[model samples]
Target: MKKVKHGGNIYEIAEKLGIQKEEIIDFSANINPLGVPINFKKALIENIDRIENYPDPEYNGLIQAIAKEHHINREYITVGNGATEVIFSMIASLKPKKSMILAPTFGEYERALMRAGSQVEYFHLKEENDFQVDDDILKTIDESFDLVILCNPNNPTSQMVENKRLIKILKHCEKNHVHLMMDEAFIDFVDEPTKETMLPYIMNYHNLIIVKALTKFYALPGLRIGYGITSNVRLLERVNDHKEPWTINSYAAMAGMVFKDKIYREKSREWITSERKDFFDELKKINKIKVYKPNGNYILFKLLEERKDLREVLLKKKILIRSCSNYKNLDESFYRIAIKDKGLNKLFAKALKEVLYES
Candidate 1:
């Protein structure tokens, strides 16, 4: 019911700080620190004149690239302005009377459900369990609920649900005639995406809808391109019918080309593999906080002994971290920090120590 403020807000921070947006070291966003792919940069620059033409409403080229990259049928995919757009559109199309979402998950799910006039319920992920989704969720989802949504490597908490457990839940939902939607937006940042992704099983489960984003893994949030995959052709058709024409722009459509940028993809893989380990270890050494073992490119930490305003202190140092207070099951003491380039990550830890220990 309350307004939600999701992160990646450098502009707002910069305005309040009376400085340029670039002055802020934004750890609030979980985007790849390797930045945009070189291929995308070159393509975008070369195709600057693309703005003169309208994007193909069907997004043929983009869809083809995505299908090829994932080795799935193009018809199984529905591209959107961002993963958020796809989420909102999918919920709108499903038009469920009651929907269940993980508490402290992405705020947009609740917002979208509310907008669609659906009664939304929360599956409160317990902090004691490191905020992971467990068997208790099975009890909460029942025939009355028409839809269930989950976020793998969930935001803010940085917790990934086990694949086997998730599959069990999906089967239960299918038997009960419930739609199951899984947001894998941050899954690519995880150490082993192939082992963790549910995308492979989509064809076998028509009720399963998997939402993915190029924003975090490819570092192209500004371009606003993401997509949803489902095997239910009828549902896909319904979603496409309800969407606004040309919601995806020319550059964004062409941006799909970057999905096949093997060099950029491998570089990101290596960066996250090394940095996530080093950064989590460093944060663990700082006893002022309780750091959750990171499986993704971000870490979730809780203040142990400090009552100081963590966000405010970090803001003063031109560093922005995600305050998890807005999430359903989290509180003021909890925060999420992006695993950035080694230099910036070290600087963040140093600044955090000064705030927690020295001053």
Candidate 2:
């Protein structure tokens, strides 16, 4: 398999452009516009000495916070360095004979599934439907496949599967004895995280496994903290066995404190509510591009004017946008960009319009 390329690599872009990484206005990685929460930063600095000792192998404190937040048993949760670790560990432990993933979804799922030596297949999300998951997916799940992966408010596309439909898929998967791995990494950015999340369903569906990232919502991607939830304790145990001990560092172990930052959470909610709409609307004004309605903090668009050089042209303006050419089912005309703060969002809109509309 060729290596999977992800967004947020400023190092290579900077080197290529002969500019500093900090100088790049990144619209690649879909992370919170708000920087790290103040309380967490303070806690990290105050407890910097904690690094002298190893993190608890069980990560009890971290799991306790997660369980408390979602009102589930700590036994239901498993932590990892990031969602990546949780994903890789879960697939390794499951050792499925075959699996399915959404095409043009997160690249990591295919990588993890392939690493586990599973036969992988793609359920391509239709471009005509704006890459939304339709009832057609229900027809795709069957007893033959042991696993199916879903990225809710899916990456790059930024479209969400309706919870009603998700329940149908969940029931269908359960009946077929297939595991449904739901990646809710960007759920925190959605308008209704509680309503959209499949977290509540994990208790009833042993086949359901939900992977989440605190790094994206809390702007601590550098610290790398994420987790998975499932009702099956045996599955959790297997995942634990696969994961290395103390994979979370001292700084990352402090991630449990982020849930208590309710004020920060509210502020982030407000920002996403206001900015996501404004940013999407701003891009839709350009007749040269077709912008999809976004449920998460990122938006995917296609250049309708036959220009494949948008990424490179935007790079010259010291702006970095995610080119979706490498993603399956997407071509060079497609791009994905993060919803940054107002000024930056406006700057990106202007930059994009100037390039696309230029005679």
Candidate 3:
């Protein structure tokens, strides 16, 4: 199968441009701008020797931390290298005969479903409706599909499924005996995540599964820590027994401490809440693009004019924004950008105006 392109490929960009990767202002990846917590870095450094030993296969401590954070049973939790691993493993274990996903959603779901030999279908999000999930999704997901994947506060579009609608879909999936795999990788970046999450329903609905990652919120992508939650203990056991040992390394196991860092968590909330609003408002002032109000840490916009090469133009200025043309339902005129710090956000807005109007 052909590999799907994802953002955060600074190495490739640096090689092509003959400049250091650090020199480029990357808005391509929707990561927390505050970066890795200082306390976590200090702990990692102090315990660097932990890498000499292999990580516990059970990952008891990591699982405990995650379980505590969500107030769920530890038996329901399964850890993986990243959310991507959890996604693939869950699909493999479920081995759905048929699956459905959002047309312009995360590409990995389709790849995983294909790997499991399941026929794939898409629920296209209409751009005219601001790419929100509509009632048509309810009709599309019936007993015919064995598995349905949802990315909350979905990528590229940064639009979330309304809580009421999401609950309705969950009940519908349950009745139809279809497994609902909700990827909450970016949920922590959204406002009122507690209300938006479906964790509370896990115990009541055996058909629901949640995949989450500390990679984006904690800025620890290199550490590769992620997990899945479901009330189906049998399925969790199957995921655990499916294969490799020590997929999560020793250092990654220590990432459990990040969950307890209340100060860092609060500061991140403050930063994202402030930056997303101000930055989006500034971008809206630009007449050349139609900015979609974001519910996540990033924003998606469409070029109003005929600038098909906007990404290329911005790259010349050492700026990197995600080109959404490669997404199944989106076209070349669309792009997604991370909401960064105050200074960087202003720089991007200024550079964008120069690209759209000045040149």
lDDT of 1 at 320: 96
Candidates ranked by TM-score: 3, 2, 1
Clashing pairs in 1: none
- Where model 1 places Cα greater than 4 Å from the true spot, the runs are 1-3
Rank by lDDT, descending? 3, 2, 1
TM-score per candidate, chains pooled: 0.98, 0.98, 0.99
What Cα-based lDDT does every candidate model obtain?
0.91, 0.92, 0.93
Cα-lDDT of candidate 1:
0.91
TM-score for candidate 2, please give it: 0.98
Best candidate (score: lDDT): 3
Error of 2 at 43 (Å): 1.2
Query: How far is 333's C-alpha from truth in model 1 (Å)?
Result: 0.7
* Tens-digit lDDT string for candidate 2 (249-295): 98887799999999999999999999999999888888888999999
Span of 10 residues, lowest total lDDT, candidate 3: 303-312
Tens digit of per-residue lDDT, candidate 3, span 1-359? 77989988999999999999999999999999889988889999999899888888899999999989999999999999999999999999999999999979988999999999999999999989999999999999999899999999898899999999999999999999999999999999998999999999999999999999999999998899899999989999899999489999988898899988999999999999999999999999999899999999999999989854998999999999999989999999999999989999999999999988886
**Candidate 3: clashing pairs of residues:** none
